[model samples]
Target: MYLLGLGLVLSLLKYLEVGPVAAWSWWWVLSPFAITALWWAWADATGYTKRKAMEKMDQRKQDRINKHKEALGIQPRKPR
Candidate 1:
C-alpha cells in the first residue's frame, strides 16, 4: 500500500514537472508501481493476503462474541 501511494505521488510529481522527479526517467518514476505489483503477486502466491484476511475475520468474530458475552454478564477472555 505504501509502495502504491509512493508510486502515485511520484507519478503525479513527474507529470507536473515538479522538482528533480521531473528529470528522472519514466522507468524510474514508474518502478514503484511495478514493485507494488510484484509485492501483491508474491503475497498472493504465499497466501499472506488470505492469512491476513482470515486473521481480521477471526478478530471481528471474537469481538462480536465478547460483546455478546458482556451483555450477558460474562467476562470476556483476556488477549494473549
Candidate 2:
C-alpha cells in the first residue's frame, strides 16, 4: 500500500514536470523494495529461513559430544 501510494505520487510528480523531486522521490521508493528482495533471495539460498536447518546443525553437534562421552563411559550432563 505504501509502495503503491509512493509510485502514484512519483508518477504525478513526473507528469507535472517537477525537476529533481520526481527523481529523488522515485529513488527513495525503489531502493527499499530492491534491497529487501535481494536480501530475501540471499537468505533463501543460505537456508536462514528454516528452523529445521538450525535444528539439524545443533543435533549434529550434540551427537558428536554424545559419541565422545560414550567412548569414555561418561554420562552426559543434563542441561541447566
Candidate 3:
C-alpha cells in the first residue's frame, strides 16, 4: 500500500538523518504503518477484498464460457 511505502521511505530518511525529516518524531514517521495496518484490517473484515477477487474470477469464468460457445458456433439459450 501507498501508506506502507511512505512509512518505509520516511523510516529510511529518519534513520539516515536526512533533510527536515530528521527532526520528526519516530511516532510521526511510523504512523503510516499503523494506518496501513488498520486499513488492511478494515478491508478484510468487511469482505471487500474477497468480493473484488470473486468478481474478477466470475468475469474470467464467463469469458471462458463465452469463448467456448463462440468456438462451437452455439446460440445462447432463450430465457423462459
Candidate 4:
C-alpha cells in the first residue's frame, strides 16, 4: 500500500513536471521493481523457492517410506 502511494506520487510528479523528475528519469523511479526482480532471482538460486520446498517434502516422504519398510521387515526399493 505504501508502494502504491509512492508510485502514485512519483507518477504525479513526473506528469506535472513540478520537480526535478525528468520524463526520462522516470526509469530511475522504477528501481524498486528492478530490486524486487533481483531479490527473486537470488532467492531462486539459493534454493529458497517453491521447488526446493517441495523437494524437502518429498525427501521427508521417502524417509517415512523407508522407515515403514524397515518396521515391516521389507527392504525399501533403491533409487534408480
Candidate 5:
C-alpha cells in the first residue's frame, strides 16, 4: 500500500516536473507499481492474505459469541 501511494505521488511529481523527482526517469518513477504487484503476488501465493482474512473472521465470530454469553450471565469458556 505504501508502495502504491509512493508510486502515485512520484508519478504526479514527475508529471508536473516538480522537485528532484522531476529529473528521475519514467522507469524509476513507475518502479513502485511493479514492487507493489510483486508483493501482492507473493502474499497471495503464500496464503498470507487468505489466512489473515480468516483469522479476522474468526475473531469477529468469537466476539459475538462472547457478547451473547455475557448477556446471558454465563461464564466464559476456557481456552484450549
Candidate 6:
C-alpha cells in the first residue's frame, strides 16, 4: 500500500517535471508499483494476506464478546 502511494507520488512528480524526479527514467519512477505488485504476490502465495484477515476477524470477534460481557456487568478476560 505504501509502495503504491509512493509510486503514485513519484509518477506525479515525474509527470510534472519536479526536481530530480524530472530527470529520473520512467522505469525508476515506476519501480515502486512493481515492488508493490511483487509484495502482494508474495504475501498471497505465503498466505500472509489470509493470516492478517483471520487475525483481524479474531480481534473483532473478541472485541464484540468483550462488549457483551461489559454490558452484562462482567469483566472481560485479560488477553494473553
C-alpha local distance difference test of each model: 0.98, 0.72, 0.93, 0.77, 0.97, 0.98
Could you tell which candidate, 2 or 4, scores higher by lDDT?
4
Please write out the lDDT profile of model 5 over residues 1-80, one tens digit for every residue: 99999999999999999999999999999999999999999999999999999999998999999999999999779768
Q: Give the lowest summed-lDDT range of ten residues in model 3.
A: 71-80
lDDT of 5: 0.97
**Model 4 regions more than 4 Å off:** 1-37, 41-48
Q: Spell out the clash pairs found in candidate 3.
A: none
Q: After superposition, which runs of candidate 1 have C-alpha atoms over 4 Å from their true positions?
A: none
Relative to the unseen true structure, what is the C-alpha lDDT of residue 35 in candidate 2, on a scale of 0 to 100? 63
Cα lDDT tens digits, model 1, 1-80, are 99999999999999999999999999999999999999999999999999999999999999999999999999998998
Winner on lDDT (3 vs 6): 6
The lowest-lDDT stretch of 10 consecutive residues in candidate 1 is 71-80
Model 4 Cα RMSD, 1 decimal: 8.9
What TM-score goes with each of the models?
A: 0.91, 0.37, 0.79, 0.45, 0.90, 0.93
Q: What is candidate 6's lDDT per residue for 2-67, written digit by digit as tens? A: 999999999999999999999999999999999999999999999999999999999999999999
Candidate 2 clashes: the total is 0
Please give, for residues 1-80, the per-residue lDDT of candidate 3 as tens digits. 99999999999999999999999999999999999999999999999999999999997987788779888999655435
lDDT of 2 by residue, 1-70 (tens): 4545565666667667587755665666456556667766877888877866788999899989988998
* Shift in Å, residue 27, candidate 6: 1.5
Q: Pick the winner on lDDT between candidates 3 and 5.
A: 5
After superposition on all C-alphas, the RMSD of every candidate to the true structure, in Å, is: 1.2, 10.1, 3.3, 8.9, 1.3, 1.0
